[model samples]
Target: MVREILRVTNISCGCNKVMVTVEDGSNFIADAVIITMPLGILKANFIEFEPKLLDRKVTAISDLGVGNENKIALRFNNVSYPCLYGSRAFVYDLEKLSDEFAANFVML
Candidate 1:
């Protein structure tokens, strides 16, 4: 059965068994426990294990981080670049653009 888990604690990993205490104070045992929490949550130390996790494991988790970059590509119809300019791409400073200039884009 798939259950909604609020928290996990008292994890004990032995030769062939894995036991954990759920938020409701119920004990659950399984062959393995798959923790799919996000890196951010894992870094927060939400779960408390019976035997504290190894320093190397904690170090690895702390060393992990995520980054993202957003990009936008624009294509203008009925537009041509001068051969002397030799480029079809134009970069704009959005903050520098006036509201009127930005409004023209919404019409497209």
Candidate 2:
């Protein structure tokens, strides 16, 4: 049976069984486990494993750089534009801005 896991901080697996430790220091066992987290979080090494990730995987994780992009959409009730059907949207490349401008801008 699969139990609802919450805030798992560590995972240990053997040939047949999987073990997980929650934030409250509670341990549980399972047949299989799936971890869902961002690449940055996985690279942070906050979660401990019985045996660490493979060396190539660790290197690949470390080699990745973080990047962010914004997407915008516009809607109209009755108005129609010239390129509405063909080219409906335009992508504003924020990467074109200076590093200083990007650093100062806030998403929210």
Candidate 3:
């Protein structure tokens, strides 16, 4: 299998042209471009374009919220708890009950 890779840097936007500096320090231009990057990076102002983007697009981008989630995996050395049939043990807090809870052990 063959893999093709392109590395672009020093991106700049003009009235009708998109300029970029390649790995070899050569300049390249394009007419129209579509950028598909993480919303967080765009919000951080890491990449700058010559001409600002559309107001709607900017608003849409700013309105977006990105979050970080973590998944944990646990392995018990021994099964100390007893299980009967299909019964399961879960922890809950009555004072902090949330509407997002659809099931006993499920959280949204």
> Which candidate has the highest TM-score of all?
2
Candidate 2 lDDT over 28-77, as tens digits, reads 88888877877777789878888777899889989998789789996778
| Native RMSD of candidate 3 (Å) | 10.2
Candidate 1 RMSD to the real structure: 13.2
State each model's CA lDDT, in order: 0.69, 0.72, 0.60
lDDT of 3 at 37: 62
Candidate 1 Cα outliers beyond 4 Å, as residue runs: 66-108
Q: Candidate 3 residues 5-104, lDDT tens each?
A: 4444457876778786655677667885555667787877666555666789888988989999799987889753333233232333422445444244
Please provide TM-scores, in order, for all candidate models, with all chains considered together.
0.53, 0.56, 0.41
Steric clash count of candidate 3: 0
Return whichever of 2 and 3 wins on lDDT: 2
The sequence of per-residue lDDT tens digits that candidate 1 reaches over residues 6-95 is 577568787798888877799888888776666777788877776788999999989998567599899878654322332333334433
RMSD of each: 13.2, 10.6, 10.2
- Give the residue spans of candidate 2 off by over 4 A: 1-5, 72-108
